[model samples]
Target: MFRRKTTEEVPAQTEPRPERPGSKGRPTPTRKEAEAAARERAKLAQDPKAMRKKQREMRVESSRQVRQALKSGDEKYLPARDQGPVRRFIRDFVDSRLGFTELLAPMLLLIIILGTGVLGENMRLFSSTLWIVTIILVILDIGWLRFRVRREVRARFPEESLKGVVWYAVMRAVNMRFLRLPKPQRKIGEALPERYR
Candidate 1:
């Protein structure tokens, strides 16, 4: 029955640990140092000249990459007109043939010169007729190219859209072989492999 009640004393609030000098741990930066770093960061971010220079450098690098991609026939970097296996097949198909479309530019120049009376009046009629014939021939050749490309694309890649592909092929055909991008993987008159058909 003689149980005694013990009283406990509470500890007072402790002070923060003092920072050790010359320790191997990272030293806390002073306020001025932090402000200086912040100012440097802000200067870099806000400088218009620097931003513009960076953008220009990026654009040049991008242009270089795109040009290389086009030269190498890299599908990832190709434009929408040249993308896809179907378009590649169409390019190969058109490139492999000796298309009349290849003469289009020269024929146009001939027509222009002839129509301008570079040839005498007596030959004017001949020039006019020649122009009409050339136009007809170009149309016919384009139609034939479209037809052949369509038939082959249908046989090879039925799911792809024919929208831009025909125009792409026509454009490629009209361009001189040496100037065409992704330069002519096959020689003129080379037959497409049977598998592509």
Candidate 2:
């Protein structure tokens, strides 16, 4: 501590003061380079084939994320529904054709069954009814999974919208039920860069 000659006391200054740089300027990327980069991003977002490829990549990454979450004892993953073409059709089918999604359908089905029992000639119709129920449930299951994976991607990335419409369509195709099972195709681990894995 040091006593100021004119005032009171001033604390001892021991730390070295940091020096500020005198001249600093923003970096300037070449115009040609900037244009090239922009084009590359647009291609990634708009190219149908590239978009499909990214969707396949996303599927694999999603599976790995699930496996890792399970291994680490975290209950964080949940699914979200996108209003895209596939989801729209699936939701519509579930809503209109299958009574399994809305309570009204099940209730109506119950009513139909009771009415059929009373009517007495349409009991054979129950067989077809049961088959329809099974199909609806299967579709619902696939829709549910697709929604979940899409949700995980949204939560993990910064982009609210996907690259573009074409890419989105491609991704939707790649994430089809037939392609997305945990079979022995290329995996997230295999697809990722070595450093990321």
The model with the greatest lDDT is: 1
Prediction-by-prediction clash tally: 0, 0
When summed lDDT is taken over every stretch of 10 residues in candidate 1, the lowest stretch is 16-25
Best by TM-score: 1
The alpha-carbon deviation from the true structure for residue 31 of candidate 1, after best TM-score superposition, in angstroms, is 28
Give TM-scores for every candidate, taking all chains together and pairing residue i with residue i: 0.70, 0.23
Q: State each model's CA lDDT, in order.
A: 0.81, 0.46
Candidate 1 achieves a global lDDT of 0.81
lDDT of 2 by residue, 79-107 (tens): 33333333332222222221222343444
TM-score of 1: 0.70
Give per-residue lDDT, candidate 2, residue 94.
27
Candidate 1's residue-wise lDDT over 124-194, tens digit each? 77778988888888899999998988888887787767777788899899998889986677878888876
